[model samples]
Target: METRQEAVTGTIGCATAVLGAFAGIAVWFPYGRTALFGAFEGETNPTDLWLGLPVLALGGAATAVAVLTAVQGRRRIAVGLAAATAALAAFGYAFDVLAAPQALQDCGSPC
Candidate 1:
């Protein structure tokens, strides 16, 4: 049986993680992908930077919280949420590297 405080922490952590994941995915299509690739090539878009910053910040914060919850609660659900949060945070980079190599190369100023 979990205490109320533990439950609350788990809930907040889960919600934050979900929100962060959603924000990351939502921005990735319109701004994140191009922004990220452009950054690699020294041609970042202002719009992408503006949009990506907050999303990345949220994801980082959420991941931290989820990890904290998992460690503090020592519960299976909390652990699962932490793992899911981490995976979601990594999904965009994975997609870019594995599935969108051509797209990345196409972005940024002509060489």
Candidate 2:
């Protein structure tokens, strides 16, 4: 049987890991697709690049902080913040992915 401390640590670790993984996917999945297939021709909207890179950095920072705090048992607030950050990044990536189609559709050939 797991002790109380062990159980708590295990739960925290699991949550932190899941949060971290989702955060990674949130950022990577969108950008990875662009990298794999190449950007749309005449795609000049810099918004995706501008938005994605920062969130990935923020998510990374949050994940690091969450894992550290969870391990030390000094704070749960950081873990909560990390989860929120991950969710926000996921939403942001989804937004960018969804918007890409519309953005491309709006571009016209002027030449």
Candidate 3:
């Protein structure tokens, strides 16, 4: 007897988890030296590798939980997880947009 809302939330949560995982991987294995390059594209920086690894792990875990909860008919939990994931995604994207220019400016080419 799962509600439609719960199903939707579960789906969203799963999507968010996937997105987060990708973002985390990108951060950890950046293709470029600067965050700006990596933000929009697939760039990696050795120095920041450590920082991104944890995010990747967390994203994967969250995604797993969301999927499990959804499957178990825990609609409320799934929805909450999805909402949180959406919020995090939104904030991360915003930060990338706002921070890109600054990162580029700081690095000054070859970034």
State how far residue 39 of model 2 sits from its true place (Å).
Answer: 2.4
Query: What RMSD does model 1 have?
Result: 7.7
Per-residue alpha-carbon lDDT of candidate 1 for residues 43-108, written as tens digits (9 for 90 to 100)? 655544554555465665566566666677657766665666566557546443223333356666
List ranges where model 3 is wrong by over 4 Å: 1-56, 97-111
Scored by lDDT, model 3 comes in at 0.56
1 or 2, greater by TM-score: 2
Q: Candidates' lDDT values, in order?
A: 0.58, 0.62, 0.56
Which candidate's lDDT is highest?
2
Q: Give the clash total for candidate 2.
A: 0
What is candidate 3's CA lDDT for residue 11? 91
Query: By TM-score, highest first, what's the ranking?
Result: 2, 3, 1
Listed in order, each prediction's TM-score against the native is 0.37, 0.46, 0.44
Candidate with maximal TM-score: 2
Candidate 2 C-alpha lDDT tens digits along 1-111: 889998987687666666665666575656645643446663444455556555565575567657667667767777696777779668676766324533356558852
Q: How does model 3 score by TM-score?
A: 0.44
Error of 1 at 71 (Å): 3.1
Clashing pairs in 2: none
